[model samples]
Target chain A: MMLNLFHLTVLSFISSLKEETLPVAEFVNKSVKWITEKFSWFFDPIKNDFGDKLEDFADMLAEIPPSIVIVLVVLIAFFITGKKFGLATFSLVGLLFIYNQQLWEELMLTFTLVLVASLISVIVGIPVGILMSKSNLAENIIKPILDFMQTMPAFVYLIPAVAFFGIGMVPGVFASFIFATPPVVRFTNLGIRQVSKELVEASDAFGTTGSQKLFKVELPMAKTTIMAGVNQTVMLSLSMVVIASMIGAPGLGREVLSALQRANAGTGFVAGLGIVILAIIIDRITQNLNKESA
Target chain B: MPVIKVNNLSKIFGKKTKEAQKLLDEGLKKEEILEKTGCTVGVNRASFEVEEGEVFVIMGLSGSGKSTLVRLLNRLIEPTEGDVEIDNENLAKMNKDDLRKVRREKMSMVFQKFALFPFKTVLENTEFGLEVQGINKEERSKKAKEALELVGLGSFIEQYPSQLSGGMQQRVGLARALANDPEVLLMDEAFSALDPLIRKDMQDELLDLQEKMQKTIIFITHDLDEALRIGDRIALMKDGSIVQIGSPEEILINPANDYVEKFVEDVDRSKVLTAENIMKRPETVDIDKHGPRVALERIREQGLSSIYVVDRSRNLKGYVTADDVSDAKKQEKKDLKEILRTDMPTVEKDTSIQEIFDIIHDASVPVAVVEDGKLRGIIVRGAVIAALANGNEVNGDDA
Candidate 1:
C-alpha cells in the first residue's frame, strides 16, 4: 500500500513538472544564440587574440630543439635555485627520457597549455582575491561563484566552451581555465586576510597609504601562500590536459586519448609515463622556487 | 607651550556614535550609554596638554581608554568628537595628505607588540618613516643608523625582527620611531609585553633617551608603577574618562576619589615619592659668617643636634654637629669651616625615597637634598617613614 502511494505521488509530481514542458534547453539555446549574435564582437576578439597567442607560444616551445630546451631548463633550475644540481640533473634526464619516448613535441604542447592557463588564472585571480580580502560583500558574492566554477564537472564546461569557441585549442583552454582558477583566487584571499591585525594597525599608524600597505606589507608577506596557490593552479591546469585533448588540443593528452581509442597499451603506457615525468619536472621546479622565496 | 593639546576628545566604537555621544553629553556613564545605544565608548571627552620634552603618561586598566586616547592624539583612531592640536595646528581638520605629512614629520609611535614588519630587516624597519617621507637613500640610511645606535641596536640592524628577542624587537620599534626625528612621540603600551626585568630596563633606557632627545612624549600604560616611574605628569582614566591628572607624587598624596585611592593603596610610596616631593626646609648657618660659637647658637636655637653649613652664596659647604661646634668653641676656633663635617649624606632632589633609606639609616644629620652644588631641602628619616606609612596624609611639616 505504501509503495503504491509513493508511486502515485511520484506520478503526480512528474506529471505536474513534465520535462518536455520545462524551457531549460530553449532558454539556454536562446541565451547562447543572443550572446553569439549580439556580443560576438566582444568575445570574438578575445577568443581570436588569446587563442593565437596560445598557439604561437605552444609552437615556439615545440619548435625549440630538445637538447637546447633541456640545457635551458637545467641552467634555469641551477641558477634560480643555486646549488640544486640534483634537481637540474633530474630535469635534464627527465626531458631526455620524454625525447627518447618521441613525445617531446607533445610534452612541449602540454607545457605551453599549462603555462598559458596558469598565467591567465594568476593574472585574473590575484586582484579578485585582493578585492575579496578587502570587502566582505565582494567575498560573499564571489565565494559561491568560485565554488560553482570549481565544483562543476570539467566536461560540462567543455560543452559550453566548445559551443562558444568551437572544438579546438581555444575551447580546450577556456575549459581548463574555468577548471583551474579557483585555487589561486582562494589562496590569495586567504593569505591577505591572514595578515596579523597588529601589523595592519602598525602600517596604518605609520601613515602608509592603502596601496603602499598592500604592495609593501601585505603582498610580500602573503607571497608564500599566493605562490602555493599558483602551484595548485599549475597542477590543476596540467590535470585538465587530457580532458582538453578530447577537443583536439594537441599534447601528451592527445597521444593518450588516441592510444585509449586504438587499444594500444604500449603507446598509452609511454604517453602516461611521459606526462608523469613532465608533471614531476614542473612540480619540482615550482616547489623549489617557493622554498627559495620562503 | 604644550606640544600636543587634546580638547573634549571622545571615541565611541559603533554606528550609533552620534546617539551615544549625545547620551555622553547628557552625563550618561559608559555602561549606561552602552545600554542606551549599543555603542562602546572607547574614549570619553578626554582633554589634556602635553608639554614639550615632557613624558605625559596615560594610565588605566585594559578597557579604560588609555590606548584609545594615545591613538587619538596621533589621529590613528579618529575621534568621535574632539579637537587635537599638534603644535597649535588642528589634527582633526587635516586632510589625508596633511595627516600623513604630520605623521611622517611631527609624530611617530611605538607599539606594545613591537609591530616590526616581519619581512623587513631592522635597518629597513628603522628607515621606514624616512622612506615614507621620500628621503634620499644615503641620508635616510645614515639617519636610521644613528637612531639604531641610539637605541643600542646598531649590531642587529641586518637581522629580521623575528630573529630578535621581544625586548630587542621593541628597541627596534623605538629606533624606527626615533629615526624619523619627530617632534612628538606616542608610545602605546610599548614595554607591556616584555618580561619584568626587560620592561624595567626599557623604562630606564627610555628615560635615558628622553634626557638626550627631549621630545614631547605621550606614553600609555596599564601599570601604575611604570606611569609613576617615567611620567612627568600622569592622567588616570576610568571607564573611558580621565579621573585624575597630576604628577605621580600628587596622585599618590591626593587621589581624586575612592577609586583612585584604592588604585594607589598598594603602591610602594618610597619608590614613587622622590626627594623633591618629600624634602623640607633645612636650618642652616653660613660657614663664613661668625665662628663655631654662632653655629652652636643656631643649632641650640633650632633645638637641633646638627645644622647644615652653607657659604654666603647658599652653596652647601657641609654640616656641623653641636658637639663639634662646642669643641670648636672651647678650642676658640676662628673658622667654623674646620668643624664642618663635609661627609654628611647628601641626595639629589630627584632621588627616590627608597634610595635614601641606606644613606639616612646610620646618619645623625638629615640627608641634604642637593641639586648641582646648592642645597634645596633636606630629607629626614622620620619624614620618609611618615610618607611611607600614610601616603595621602603626608604634609609639609612631616617632611
Candidate 2:
C-alpha cells in the first residue's frame, strides 16, 4: 500500500510539469534557427565557392583513367608493404571490381572526401594533440570537447554543421571533421605522452628548445602512435560517408542512398560492396604503412 | 671555482609545496612532511660542489634522491627550493634562455636507460645534442663521428640504436653526450642496466676517457662498488639528504654512521683493496752482490720456498726458489741471477687485489709489487686472501 502511494505521488509530480513546459526542444530549435539566420552571410561564400571547389576536385579525380589509378595505387601498395604481391593483387582486384560495378566515379568522389577530411584532421589534430600532451590546462579543457565530439551520436553534429555550412560535401566534410578528428587528437596526445621519460630528460638535459624537442625527440618517438591515430581518422571518415550522403554529398554513399530510395536490393548491395572493398583496401594500406615505419 | 655548485637543492613533488616547504624549513623529517602535506621529498636541501675535472659521485639506494639531485644540477627537474650555480651564474634563477644556453654549451647527460632515438641511426642519435645546439650539419656530423669513435662505436654508427647491445647503446649515449663537447658530463646511473662484466668494462673505459679528457663529471650510481671505483669524491644520500661527503678512502675507512657502515660492509673488499695496502716488505737477495748460495741461505733462514732477487739499486730483477738456488750452488753456478725465475708476475702498487687474485691463486712465488721499475713491496697469496676476508685490516700489515 505504501509503495503504491509513493508511485502515485511521483507520477502526479512528473505530470504536474510535463510536455513543452521543459522548452528544451523548442529552445534548441530556436537556437539553431537563430544561428542559421545570423550566420547566413558567413556560410554563403563557404557553401557556394568551397562546395564548387570540392566538387571540381572530386570531378578531376574521377576524370583520371580508372586503369591508371588502379595501377598507381597498386604500385603504392606493393612498394610500401614490403613489396607484398598479395596486397598488391588485392588492391588491383578490389579496384577492378568497383570499376566493373559502374561505381568508379562514385568511388573517386568518396576517395576525395575521405582523403581531404583525413588530411584536415591530421593537419589540425596533431598540433592540438601536441598541445594537449605538453600542457595539462589544454588537456583538461580540450579533452571534454573531444569527448563531446566523439560520444554524442555523430548525427547531432549534422544539425550545427548544416546550419553553418549548408547542404552538400561542404557540410559532409564539416560533419566528418567533427566525428573523425577525436581519434587523431586523442591518439596524438597519448603517443607524445607515452614517450619514455628518460628520453625526454636526455633531450632537456642537452638544453633542447620547445620546437627542437618536439620535432627531434618527442614526435619521432611518437610517430607510430600518431600514424595509428591518422589511420583511425581516415577509417572513421570512411564510416561517415553513407551518413554524409543524407546531406546531398556526392559519392558511393549517394548511389547507396538512391538504391535504398528505389527499393532496389541489387543496386544497393552492389554499391555497399564497392564501399566495403574500398574500406578494406584503405585499411590494409594504412596498417601496412604503420608496420613499415615501426 | 667548482665547475658545478649545488646549494641546498630540494625537489618536493606535490601540489601543496608551499606548505611542504614551510614544513621542510621547520626541520620536519621527510616522513613528517609527507604526513602533514602529502608531498614526496625527492631531494631535501642537498648541497654539494663538483670541482673541475673531478668525478664527483652521488650515490645511494633507489629512491634516495640521487637521481633527483643529479637532475637538479642541469635543471631537468626544477628545484622546489635553493639554487644550482654553474660556474658563477645561478642556474636555478636564470631565465629559460640563459638556462638553456648553460645546458647546450656547458653540460650534457648520459642516462641509465641509454635513451637514444630509436628511429635514428647511431650517427644521427650521437649528433642529436650538437644538432639541437643548431650546429651546422657537417660540423655536427663530424663531431658525432669522432665521439662515436672515442666511445669505440665508430663501426656501428650507421646502425640504429635498437641494433646495438645494451653496452654499445650506452656507448652511443656516451657518444651523444660527448659530441656536444660540453665541459660537464652528468652520468645518472649510466651503467646500472648492463651486465656485471659489461658494467665493469664500461667503468674502466670511462676512467680511461676521464683521465685523458678530465671533463668534470657528476656520476650518479646506487652501486657502492661503482662509486668507489670511479669517484674522486662521493656524497652519500639518505631520505633525500646528503648524509656524508668525502673521498672514497675516507668514506670507506671512516663512514659517517651505521647506514654508511652497513652500506660499505657489503662491497667486495678485493675490488677496494689495492696491492699497496696489502704488500709486505720483501726479503730478497741482492743479485748484484750475492751468489746463488747466499740466496739459498736467506731462503732457508726465512723458512720460505722462494725469494725475490733485487739489484743494489733495489730494482726488481726476478725471484728464485730455494731448490733452484741450492741446485745452482751445488752445480757451481755462482750467480743468483742464473737461478732466478724472471717469469714471476709483477703488479703495480695501485693494482687492486681483484686484478692480482688469478695470478696469486696459482702462483709458485709471491707477486712483486713493482712501482716505477723499483721493488716497492711483495704480495703473496695469503695476503690477498686475508685482504678479501677482512676489509681494511690488510692496511695494518704494511709494517
Candidate 3:
C-alpha cells in the first residue's frame, strides 16, 4: 500500500505532461522476465517433474471407483468427527451428489490441487515461521513480505507464475501457494510464541537441544494452531480454484470458468456446487483432524 | 562440600550491562543502577553455595530477584558477570553441549506454574529429562514411572497434565525433574500456585522426597512460612541482593536488617517453634544416687508438683509426683523408682509446639523431651503457653 501511494504521487507528477506514467509496472515486468530467464534452471524442474507428479497423483485418485472413495471418505469423516456421523453423512451424500452430476473427475483434481498446495505451504511455512520466531531481524523482514503476499490481488501472481511454469496446474499451484502460505507461517509463528514462557523454560531446564525442543515441546504444543492455519490454507486454496482456472488449471474451476464464458448458469452453479461440496468435506475433515490431535 | 556454588553472579537486563554491573559493585541500588545505565539488575552480586543433600530456600517478596537468582544457578538466565560452578564445572564458561550436559545430568528445574507439556501424558512429561539424555526407551520409561510413583502419581501415568489437579500436576513437574536423577533440583516457587491445604500437603511430600532422595535442592518462594517449613537454610533477598543467609531459626530470631525483620514480622512462630525451644531444664533426681526422701525434699524445695526420676546416666526412668514421693517417704521407702509414674507424656525435642500443645494439654506432669530414651529437657504447660504467647521461647532454658 505504501508502494502504491509512492507510485501514485510520482504518477500524478508525471501525468501533468500527457499520456505518460510511472515505469513501475514496466520495471516489475522486466524484473520478472529477467528472473525467469536467469533462473530457468530453478523453475524448469518444478514446472516439469513436480507438475507431472501432481497430475499423476490426481489421475490416480480420479481412477478410483467413486463408491469406494465415498465410502473411505465417509468412514474417515465418521471416525475423525468422533463417530456421531454428522460429517460422515455429509461426506457420503456430498460425494454421491458430485458423482451423480458426473463432476467426480473435476472434484478429484480440485482436491489434489488444494492438498498439494497446502502441503507445500506447510513444508515451507513452518520453518520460515520458526525462523521468524527465533530472530527479531527475520521477523521484521518477513512480516512486510507476508503482508504484501496476503493483500496483493491473487490474480497478479498468475502472470509471473505462468511466465515461469507456463499455463498448467503447476502455476495454479504456485499462485495458490503464495496466497495460502501466509496464514500457515503466521499461525505457526503465533502458536510457537504463544507457548507459555514457563513451558519454554521447563523444556530448556531439561537441556533439550534446539531441534529436540522444537519437535518435542514447541511443535506439539503448537500443533493445534498450525492445524488451524493449515485448515485455512486448504479452504483458501479451494477458493483460488476459479482464479486458477484462468491459467488452464484443470478441475471444477475449469468448469466454472468455461461456464462463465459461455454464460451457462446452470452448469456453473453445478460446478460451483461441486467446489462447495469438496470444500465442506475437506474443511470438516481437517478441523476434525485438528481436534483429534488436540 | 557445596554441590553448587555461585560466585559474585549478576544478571543485568539491558545492553549497558558493564556500566550497570560496575555501578552495582559500587553499591548503587537496583533502581539507581537502572537510572544511571538504563540496565535493570535482575540479580546483583548474588553468591551462595548449596550443600549436597540440603534444601536451601531463597526467600523474598515479589520482584526481589529470588526467581532470577534460582534461574541464574541453572544458567537459564545468563549471568552478566561471575560464575556458577556445579560440581567444579563453570556453567557460564561451558559451550552449548557442555552446558546441556550439565543441565541434563547434573541439574533440573521444577517450574512454579507446573509447566508440564499440556500435549504430553504424565509419563511423557516425567520422561522428558531422561529422554533428552538419550536414555533407552525402556530405562527412561521405567525411571519416569518410578519417579511418578515416587511423587504418588503412579496410577495417573497415562493421564495428561490437564486431567490432573494443580497439586498433582506439580507432582508431575517434580517427578519430571527427579526422573533425570540430577544431583540438584531447582524448584521455582514449586508449590506457590496450589491451594493452602494442598500446598501444605505438597510441602510435606517434598520434605519426604528430600529425605528419601537426598538431592541438593534450591527452592525459591515469596512465602516465609513455606521457606521455614521446608528450608534447612534460608537466604533472605531484597531488591536483587541477598540480605542474609541463615537457618530459619537464625533468620527468625535475629533478622539481618529491617527488611528481613519486616518480612518475617507477620510469621506465625508456632510453626517454627519446637519442643526443644520451649523445653525447660527440669529438676530431676537420680534413682541410683538418691532415695524417695531426697526426691521428696527436692520437689518440695523446687516447689514443684512433680520431679522426674532418672537413672545414673540421666535416662528417664519416669516422673515422681510430690504426693507419691512424700507418701513413699512416709512409708520409709528407699527407692524413688518404685513410686515414679511412667504415664507422663513423652515427646521428641524436634516436635513442633503445636504437637507439643496437644501432647502436654492432657498430661498431668510436664512432657519429657526425650532423645533415645535419655531425657533432654521438659516442656511444661506454662512454658509451652509462654512460647506461644510471646512468640519466642521464654527463659525456660534458665532452669
Q: DockQ of every model listed?
A: 0.53, 0.67, 0.71
What does candidate 1's lDDT look like per residue over B96-130, in tens digits? 99888888888899999988898899999999888
Summarize candidate 2's per-residue lDDT along B235-330 as a digit string, tens digits. Answer: 999989999999987787678998998899988887787888788999988988999878878888889999988888899998888888888988
Pairs clashing within candidate 1: none
- Alpha-carbon TM-score of each model against the true structure: 0.88, 0.85, 0.87
Ranking by TM-score: 1, 3, 2
In candidate 2, position B291 carries an lDDT of 92
Docking level for model 2 = medium
* Candidate 3, superposed: residue stretches over 4 Å from native: A1-22, B279-348, B355-386, B392-399
User: Model 2 segments beyond 4 Å from truth?
Assistant: A1-20, B21-27, B275-388, B392-399
Between prediction 2 and prediction 3, the one with superior TM-score is: 3
Write down the RMSD of candidate 1 (Cα, Å).
4.4
C-alpha displacement of B162 in model 3, angstroms? 2.5
For residue A15, what is the lDDT in candidate 1?
Answer: 86
Residue A221 CA error for candidate 3 (Å)? 0.8
Global lDDT of each candidate: 0.88, 0.89, 0.90
Task: Give the per-residue lDDT of model 1 (tens digit) for A85-182.
Answer: 88788888888888988898889888888888888889999999999999999999999999999998898878667667766678777888899999
Predicted candidate 3 versus true structure: per-residue lDDT over B1-399, tens digit per residue: 898889998888999999888888888888787788899878888889989999999999999989998988888888888899988989978898999999899998998899988888999889999888889999999999999889999999999888989999999999999999999999999999999999999999998988888999999999999999999999999889999999998887678878988888788877887887778887999979999888878888989999988898889998888888888888988987677788879998789988888888789888999999999999878887777776533555752
Tell me the tens digit of each residue's lDDT in model 2 across A207-265.
Answer: 89999999988998899999999999999999999989988888999989999999999
